[model samples]
Structure formats: structure tokens, C-alpha cells
Target: MLARLGAISLSLSMILLLSMNYGSFALVGFLSATGLIALVVLHPWTARLTDRHGQGKVTAAAAGIAALSYAAFLACAHWKAPAWTLFPAYALAMGSSPNVSGMVRRRWAHLHDGSTRRAANAVEQVADELCFLSGPILATILVTSVFPEAGVLASGVLLVTGMLLFAGQRRTEPPADPAAGRRESSPLRRPSVWAVLMPYALVGILFGALDVTTVKHTTSMDSRSAAGVLLSMIALGSAISGLAFGKVRPRSEPRVPFIVSVAALAVLTCVPLAAARLLPDSLPAIGAAMFAVGIGTAPVIILGTSIVQACVPEARLNEALVWPSSAITGGNATGNALTGWIVDHAGDSSGYWVPVVVGPAALLAAYAGLALHRRTDDDCVAAEDVGV
Candidate 1:
């Protein structure tokens, strides 16, 4: 989760930093686009590497590269280097980011199965929500209160530090399954895997768009500092619900909760529009709406992660789970670039429309998955078909 802090914190910090320093959301978005491309391109290779080598050795190597990348990015920012230089440097940093969050889930899955796994997934979701809850607030506060460079610097520090610490936790690492290396069935080739991943890709877009838009929206009102707090409200809502969700037992198929949460998220996204229309100018009102919209975020995430864990075999868990993480970061990259440009050309208010539009698209993907796979409630049973 520390790596997540670095990633998300960097995103929030960089979006504001690049836009404020460069005064070009289009440029910022373009930079984010490069990152999105790099992440997607490297997805399979990274997953395979983790599968073959264990998480610790791979993560340590990645952490070293990431440290160098962060230094390069900071140097560029400090010197006001040519815009062209930021793209590769930032992409390297983003692309090399270790998936410690995914590793944590792997650890939990290693220890538990059945109803217990659900609880662990719920806790993992809560940890994620907490990161979201704290990441922006910590990042922005540092940037706003300390030095303009402080947020990115702090994010980099947390990322490197968190990763090294996690890498050292060798005891909890999943046993290196030798057969996993020889497995022919890639998670990408599975229809059931894609069934869950597709809707999540849109969900990633929703999260990314929401971040860029919220910052732009609050910044427009001269309450730029309030951006972190309003953003935290969204995480706060999710964290609260995540806690409650952990206690309940599943009553239906995994897809049922998946669809319900997506639908709720799609519908609650409207709360922001309604809040804006009614109050027209209150930051508090927008904060309230953001919190409500966040309510649906965790349930969808918790259920989605649980679904992936259940469907994929233990050997391929890393390969399969990485896709959802990829979707989020890749989607975030897409959201940042797209919404940043929309805010630049159209108007700040236009950024708000992104989530409203993307939310239902996620719901559609969820329903489509429902029809396509129709997997039973026994989705918890592992499917090992692909390793032919």
C-alpha cells in the first residue's frame, strides 16, 4: 500500500504541479498519455517477471530503478528542464512502480480461503481506501504548505521506503510454485478473467477522471487547497463502507455484488451534478457529494478483487490480479490526459462530466460480464484450464 501512496500521491501532485508550472493541461495530459501507454505495454512482461522470479527480488530491483527515476524527475522539475525530458522520466517512474498492494493481497490469499478470504479482501480494500483517503491530503498539504516540490519528493520517498520494507518481508511471500513458470495459460487468454477486467478498466477511468476533475473544479474556485480535503471525503466514504462491507457474509454470486456496487457507483455519480446544480458555489456541498459517490467505490473494488482471486488458480494469481491494477493505473493515465485537456479547452465545469459519463459505462461493462461468463456462485473454486 505504500507503493500505492507514492503512485497516487505523485499523480495528484503532478497533475497540479505540471498544470500550475506549465499552465497546460493538454501538455500534462499528453505526459500522462505516455505513462498510460508504457504501463499497458509493459504489463505482461512485468507480470511474467513477478511470476518467474519471486516478489521480493523483483520488487527490490524495481525499487532501485524507481528511486533513480524519481531522482531524474525531481532534477528535471528543479532545473525546469525542457518539457520533452519530463515524459520519459515520469514514464519510467510510473512504469517501474512495484505492485506492493497486489502483493499484500497475494499474501492474504496465501493465508486464507473461503469466507475468510472475503474478510481479508475487505481489509485490503479498506487499506486501499485509507491510502486514497490519506495520499492526496498528505501530498497536497506538503506541496501547498511546505515547498512546491515537497509533495513529489515525499511521494517518492514513501514509495521507495515502503517498497524496500515490503521486499524484506520474505517470510510472508507466497511459495514459488515451479509449475507456474511452465504454465501455458496466460490469464489474459481467459474469457472469465476478461469478464471481470473489462468493467474494471472503466472503473479505473472513473477514478482517474475523478481525480483530475476534482482538483480542477476546486482550483477554479480559488480554494485550490480544499482539493485534498474534498478528495479525502471521497476516500472517507469508501473507507467507512469498506469497514461495514467486511462484516457481512455473501448471500449471492460474486457477480451479484459486483453488479450492485457498479450500479450504485453509476447512480451516485449523479450526486455531484445535483449538488453542483443546487448549491452552485459551495465547496462543502461538493465535498458531501464526493463522499456519497465514494460510498460505492469500495464495494465494487472489494467484490472485484474477491472475484479475481476466486476465479484464478493460486499459481496464476499474480498474473491475473495484475490486470485490475493495470486497468486502474492505465485508466488513470487515460483519465488524467483526457480530462485535463477537456478542462483546458472546454471549461473547468466540463471536467465534472467525465465521471458522470464514465460511471454508467462501467455499469454496462459489469452487466456485459454477467451475460458473457454467467459463472456460478461457486466462483471461489479455482479454474486451472489455461496452463495447457
Candidate 2:
């Protein structure tokens, strides 16, 4: 239920905000960037609160605050509120971003062991992708068929309902640790945590570039209506890949998937550039290529996440997980903002270049990490022998 609430809130809010005034690309970009920053800033506090109090209490509070924020946004919209009022309201709504994935992962780690834990993590990843795909379409229908504000209101309702249900579940809430206080004192001081996170930061940048570039490219080629479809295709592709990957048996070296996924993504990146050259004037052709590109996204994300989960200690798992989320959000926000500026000043031709540059850079980062892993394989052998 916590996961469901988080998904609904995030999906509904994104679709409503993006679809309502997508014509104003600059404003959308600015709001997304700022909102992501606000969320990233609040993450540590959110994690700390959950650790100290409980996942239930923290989740309930965040959901309630998020619901109120949505309500305020609706009221502001009704009253023709200026940017000053709306901006804060928007930031507040986004800032209450739920740590649903992290929370679930922690719970899974606590309840399960060995291969079961890995399977649970993979299932969660697939679920995340599923939510991303379904959430937007639901939001799109609500906003377009009913009213724009309706989407926001619906988000609040879903958030409240899901949170209440989740909070009621005994097993869903994590068991309280006697040493929780000491454990939370200084999580980031560990070197292994940083080792797991550093590469993800670079991957996050690539994801961000891909997300914004896809949005900008589709909107330019077709219409704002097409943006939702394009985004949906990407999510759908990822969801399918994640589901398939999750069902597979565990391998001796999980990094094999990680390496393959990143390589595929790098190669797939060229598809857009090819589309730009070969079908320069064809929207349909570009959309097809975008969909194919989406196919590689989920596998890369899931594999990378699996690698991180395997690398980190159980105690530091939650803290380590937060970095990837923060990195992705930060990357997406920065990439969208930068791409928006480039498109505005440099013309549509500049949009294709975003992916072209980011793709190779991300691939290089992944390979470099892989190289480091190989060099340290002898030392890691004892660790891997134990089986995470």
C-alpha cells in the first residue's frame, strides 16, 4: 500500500503538471528541476525520520503533507495564484516525495535471505517500472476527460487511501532495531557505500539526459499529446524487461547483466541519431526509434540496482539506495533544464546531441566501474563466495 500510494502520488502529479502547460517548456523544465532539488534535499531528513519513528509514521506523514500540498495547488489554480504562490506549493508537493522503493527494499532485506532477497528486489524494480507506465495514463485521462485540477485531487485521494492501507499492514512495517539510533549516526562514512554509488551518479546523468531529450524531441516532432505516448512506451519497455530479468535464476557474476545492459543502451543511443539523419522529417519513424530505445532502459536500471544491492552491506543498504535515487533525480533535473535551455537557444537540432554525448559518457563510466571490479576480483572472491 505504501508503494501504491507513492506511485499514485508521483505519477498523478507528474502527468498533471507536465500535461497542463507543456506548451511552456521552459516553465515545466524549471518546475521539474526545482521540485527534484527540493525532494533530494528532503530525502536524508525523510530517511532519518523513518529510522527514528517508523516507516508507517513517516510514510503517513509524508503522504498527508503531500495530499495537502496538492489541495493547495488546486486552490491556487482556482484563484489564479501567481508564480510566487504556486512555486512554493509545487515545491512542497514534490518535496514530500515518498521513499517507497527504499522502504520496501529495507523491509525485504529484513524478511528474506539469499536468493529470495534478490528475487524480491528484482520484483520491486519491476513494480516500479509498472507504476511509472500506468500512473501517467491514468493521470492523462483524469486531466483531459475531466479537468486539470481533478488530476491533482485524485492524486491526494490515492495517496491518502494507499498510505492508510499500508500503515494498517503489520508485516509491511519494518521491525524496530534496538541499535537504530547508533546505526543512523553516520551512515555515509563508509567507503564501500561510496564505491557503489559513484557509478550510479554518472548513470543518473545519462538517464536524465535521455528523459528530457526524449520529451523535447517528441514534443517538437509531433505534439504535446505525443509526449505521453512516448513516455509510456519507454516505461512499458522497461517494465517488460524488468519482469523478464526478475524471473531468471541468479548467476555467479551479476555484473554480467549490468555490463550487457549498459552496452545495449550505448548502442541504442545511436538509434535516435540515426532517426534524426535518416528520417529527419518523419515523426512516426522517430517515435518507433524512441520505443526501441525504451527497451534497453529498464534492463540497465534493474541490473545496476541489483549490482549495488549485492555490493552494499545489509546495514547500510537504505542509505546506499538513497544515493542512486538522488542521483537519478538530480541527473534528470539537471539534464532537462540544460536541454531545455539548449533547445530554446540552439534550435531543435541541439536536442539530438544531448543523448549522443550522454550515451557514450555513461557507457564509459559503466565500463570503467566494470574494470575496477575485475581488478579487485581476487579480494572480492571471498566476499562473493559468501553469497549476498
**Each prediction's TM-score versus the true structure:** 0.94, 0.85
- Residue-wise lDDT of candidate 2 within 237-332, one digit each (tens)? 777777777677545565656667777877776776688678776767666766677678777666555555665555555655676677677776
Query: Against the correct fold, how does model 2 do in TM-score?
Result: 0.85
Model 2: residues with Cα > 4 Å off, grouped in runs: 1-23, 77-80, 184-187, 214-222, 280-284, 370-388
Lowest summed lDDT over 10 consecutive residues: which window, candidate 1? 379-388
User: Whole-model Cα lDDT per candidate?
Assistant: 0.80, 0.63
Considering every candidate listed, which one attains the maximal TM-score?
Answer: 1
Off by over 4 Å in 1: 375-388
Question: How many clashes (backbone N, Cα, C below 3 Å) per candidate?
Answer: 1, 0
Across residues 106-216, which tens digit of lDDT does each residue of candidate 1 receive?
A: 888888777777888888888888998898899789878887778889889999988888889999898766578576577676666777788888877776777777787
Alpha-carbon RMSD of each model:
3.1, 3.4
